[model samples]
Target: MTQLNEKLTLKQIEAIIEEMSIDGALNKLYAFKEEYGTKVDKLIVKYEKKKLQWEKEFKRFEDMRRYEKEAYSEGVKYIAGIDEAGRGPLAGPVVAAAVILPENVFINGLNDSKKLSEKQREKLFSEITEKAVAYEVGIVDEKIIDELNILNATKVAMEIAVESLKVKPDLLLIDSVKLDSLKIPQKSIIKGDSLSISIAAASIIAKVTRDRLLEEMDSIYPEYGFKKHKGYGTKEHIEAIRKFGICPIHRVSFTKNFTL
Candidate 1:
């Protein structure tokens, strides 16, 4: 250690500290801290803070995996988490996603879609789809939402997502909703998106897919601000409906209240 420290410049040692794990860097840097004074002391403090923060985030991630771990213990090889978005939107389709992730897969900062910003949801959507063993989304349009009603339409969307999965899941972890149409074993966890990593991944996928559709509708209709609110019954959206009346994409059932 003494020989190597003598040969290496302080700048080079700092670079090494930056690259190595906090544990290893601490071991190597502590001896140098007294000699190097403030410079090395600062690096040690920085990475000690980083180490604590990382441990906190990693604990959150592992806690989110509780459901998946239980399923794996039961010999469930593939578990798909299902969640839906846009059921409350006044326009655009209800979208649901089914995602089967590898056992104990780690996605940094994963949580319920509603908890994330648009950019964060978009980033997680891409990463979830890419890493998932099988991922698929189902969309049921405004017309279907009017016909089947939001609850039924959402169920249909979930069924479609599950059916479309390339690799059939042995079990389904749904977010506060259950589809009895499917033969797969299932559990509905209230706020599952917050509780389960798989459900959170699906929530991100479904939300992003629905948001993209609304953005496309925005280009077509331009006046409703679908892109801005994603067709939810915001004050602006309601005002637009009153100003221009409903567009073709507006859910008749949802916007009927605006007309009355």
Candidate 2:
């Protein structure tokens, strides 16, 4: 009998269930089979259906693991992914993250931060930080973003986050931007967060960090709806900005519907 508590892939668990059924482990079979009903023949079918669901989830993680291994090779011991959030927002800080995850750490359903729901991202964000070998965050405030322009400010923030890391990465996997000053080898992968696990991890970190900052801003500027939209120029945010004018965190350079 296969141990259910062991960390078996969903596929493996399904296989064990099938084998147990073939040998007529009724107690074990009935335990899982109860989800379907009491009919013996129906139970077999139910097991298959449930097994398929697990297989899909298992495959998702397996694919992610394969990519991590590929990147881990090529002499890249510490491959950090870089990404930023709050660039287009009219207020709050621009946040960036540099994350060097463990070589063997595998988390399911990690992808571009934009594609994930807030709940999913929050869960994965915690997992990444706990499991990563080294991680760092950089924040460029609204005033600085306005003064330096978003592109340059984003670059500065990214560099700061990377430099802040305790483990200096040998290679940088970035999303659509290159750092010329950092002599380390780098690859600017277009939509890297979707394609690379490391980049996806960075995206999650940057997003969560920036969201926390905006939440804090929300407390300070209660009228701006920073907590809801995280400083983005939504309808409510625009209305609030129009009513309140730009606060200390608002980007003066941005042409919000209403500005000081």
Candidate 3:
């Protein structure tokens, strides 16, 4: 036990903590606790809590990558994850994203887009696009959604996303739905956005793309508050539709019941 100066200020000790390995820091902190008193004890506790939290995050991240690992183990290269956004929305286009991520890529706080805040999604969106091997988005507007129905429209968007990828993926890991439009070898996982990091990355890209589009639509249809709800059928948006009538961005098939 290296004897830390009994009088060392917490700020000074904190600086020392940064220089040590996590285990070394914890040991050093523990050794100093009695001499430095209660504040030092609190620091030890805080450090432990932080360490535990980090462990949880790392485990979750590793678990999220399991599907990618499986694919990689099978001699697969260029595995892409597919996910879509705006399928349930009453307005705007259904957008899908296909993202190929580097094997064992470490991205902290990566998860399903629905599980993250808008700010988090936006941040991860930038991180993913920057670090991804390749990524592409497909957008199918409300008119086509009405024509083909949401499920088929979503498939088309996903097909477009896969087709547009700069690097064609050798394997596709999709979220809950299979794409028959493309003949790419694929696996679908239920709630895959939460189960697979690749799907989560694709989810973030699809969500951010669709949200930005809805925000752009907000400028055109100010009364609908598209930016706030991102085309979801919030009461505010429903009220706006009832009052202002359906706009071009509103899915005719979806809003028909609401309008009536």
Highest lDDT model number: 3
Better of 1 and 3 by lDDT: 3
In terms of TM-score, the best-performing candidate is 1
Listing every candidate in turn, what is its Cα RMSD in Å to the true structure after a full C-alpha superposition? Answer: 2.5, 6.6, 2.7
lDDT of 3 by residue, 172-233 (tens): 99998999778889999999999999999999999999999999989988988998999999
Worst window of 10 by summed lDDT in candidate 2: 32-41
Model 3 residue pairs with clashes: none
Flag the better candidate by TM-score, 1 or 2: 1
Estimate, for each residue in 9-111, the C-alpha lDDT of model 1 and write its tens digit. Answer: 7678878777788788888788787666666777778778988988898899999999999999999999999999987888889999999999957788899
Best of the two (1, 2) by lDDT: 1
Single out the weakest 10-residue window by summed lDDT for candidate 3: 1-10
| TM-score computed on alpha carbons, candidate 3 | 0.89
lDDT rank, highest first?
3, 1, 2
In order, candidate lDDTs are 0.90, 0.80, 0.92
| Model 3 CA deviation exceeding 4 Å by range | 1-8, 15-39
lDDT for predicted candidate 3 compared with the true structure:
0.92
